[model samples]
Target: MLEKDRFFEKVIDRIDHLDRNGLKNLIENLQQKQRVLQLVFEALDEGIIITAEDRVVTMNNVARIILGYKSRQYGNFQEMDKYIANWGLWNILKFLHGEEDIRKEFTIHQQQEPKYYLVEKRTIEDNLVLYKLVDQTEKKKLQFQLKNIESVAALNTLASGIAHEIKNPLTAIDLHTQLIQRAVQKNLVCLDESILQYIKTISHETKRLNQILNDFLLAARPRQLKLSFEDINSFVQELLLLVKPELEEKNIALREEYQNIPKNFIDKDYLKQAILNLIKNAMDAMEKSSLKILTVRTWYDNGRDSTAIEIADTGCGISPDQIQKIFEPYYTTKEYGTGLGLTITYKIIKEHQGEIQIQSKPGEGTSFTVYIPIHKGHKLLDRPL
Candidate 1:
């Protein structure tokens, strides 16, 4: 027993007599390691929350950001849960408290904009659970947008096939109707005014039907772009001139805000047609309005490496519900609208590897913005001035 006591005394004496500077260095190293671990925790994109028993040990910055919690370095899950319950995360806390590990995707709709999340939980030790969360809102939105684009493309193909089959039959009907009308007028048959009117009506209706089918066909088929480098500003000026007379007739004021920008690679004919259709639609929307104004603006978007043309109208704006479906095929608000014009415009912009977006507020106005890449196969400097 005396030898054992001597060994314990020596061990205590050795630790007590350790070098001061060496102990200081060891302490500094340990503090540095803790700082590095904290930095790594904050840098992670995934949110991490760790709890010891009922108290919160720590939460990373990412977790704080994703959860919109202000206290990052100092807060317990229990304390966070007190306020975070408003964010609808209380159920997740309950899951963490359970015995089984948890992995699930859930949506929080309590906020202004719904958010999606993937939550994973595992028991780290006695009565401690580690929860990892990923904000999947943007990722899910992208997936949904991709799915919509694929659906629209498939529908366009189906519409093209159906439209192609009906074209020839429609042409034959129209030709026969015209021939009957001509025969009636030529006195080939003793037909009354009513009979002649009926024949004329058939011709008119067939022509209208043919126009609708033509629109679908145009949207469905792949377009071979006749790419020409042209000044977008000048092209837009030329287009406005064609619609000036119509605008004046309706007492609609046309405002132009044109900026001198670089030339763009585009299919001149296709782009012109698309812009004209938008202008026509704008004019139609303003026909019944007391205050009519059309604004067209052009500028270069250097960030996107494209040129933007925005057509805005102070006419009847589209409803929020209808705005989402405006580009959908066969969906229209106009009485005689084929609902294919905007769809075709969308397809044209997409073919040029561009983007089109619309903003509208009911009873206020609407704007359509189109972005076309400035360079396709040619460098920006090489293009004409």
Candidate 2:
């Protein structure tokens, strides 16, 4: 027990021999403590009820709210149970009527979405049961999300199989287009300029389809990673240089913050692709905004034992609904977007055992933060896997 609590107990034990003022002071002190506890109890979001010998001793304000408790002058459990029969809380009433301390789950689905709670009955003292309510709606939603992820994984496997079957026909089409292009170049077959343009369009479309198929295969399957310890700052710098002209043309201000960090074991090419996708997304989001600022930041967190890259933009931010669907395959808001960008990026990060985080406000801006472990336990030697 705490020193103050022990001292209080000693005083209470010696109460019979105390003077009148001493007893009065002890009573006032206890009342003050009770008042503080009551204030705290009422402020809590969880429902708490303390009942003794099947009689309602006391319940918190939250308990009253959850139970739809209207002030009925109830001195016993029977009266409260009758009042709550229509509140869709008969399970709680049933649990209270039992002898042994047991647990009960209260679920009400007649509302818009399901609300779940666990009303645990614990015996703090003889015939004194404490029922605590814990909300589990978010937990249920998270379980559904996990199931959806599994479904997505299954779909990816199926897509990979289908993409493989399509490869032979696509290769044949590409080869035939190359032959036709060669014949046109040599003037072996006379064709109108308009027909030549049509041929070019076919060849271009064939190449585009081939590229899309490659992306699908890559995103579904793990690549043979050439893991090496490389400086990520210079890597990001090179990418920024590659996109410099586009940034200049768009009149978007660029800000780079590269913190001194240790080299991480990574597939430079794959990681570059991931970060580039994020940068391009940031650029697209800022296309309609007048004040365009693209910020790229790199730092290391000793606590997490990870390195972080943050790309932020002053542009139209993603809504909550859009953010949820962003990583799903073929989901995008851009007019001409293929939507495989984020899916591939997500796959690459997963291959490295890293994670991506996103933060955004509707109109303000958005930030994408990627965390990669600074050191990995397994260094699968530098070779094609």
TM-score of each: 0.68, 0.66
lDDT per residue, candidate 2, 1-385, as tens digits?
Answer: 4987897889979988999998898889889988998999989878887877767788887777777777645456766765562255545555565756777777887468877877777899777878887777789889999999899889989989999989889899889888887998898988899988988898898888888888788778878777877787887898899888999999999999999988888888888989989989989999999899999999997877888899999999999989999998889888878788899999888888788999999888999998888666145443554
User: Cα lDDT of all candidates, in order?
Assistant: 0.83, 0.83
Expressed as tens digits, the lDDT of each residue in 15-42 for candidate 1 is 6676988568656866897899999998
Prediction 2 TM-score vs. true: 0.66
* Model 1 steric clash pairs: none
Q: Candidate 1 — which residues are off by over 4 angstroms? A: 1-15, 18-32, 64-81, 86-89, 102-116, 125-128, 227-268, 285-333, 353-385
Q: Runs in model 2 with CA error above 4 Å?
A: 1-66, 70-86, 91-108, 115-140, 248-259, 291-305, 319-325, 355-365, 377-385
**Looking at model 1, which ten-residue stretch has the lowest summed lDDT?**
376-385
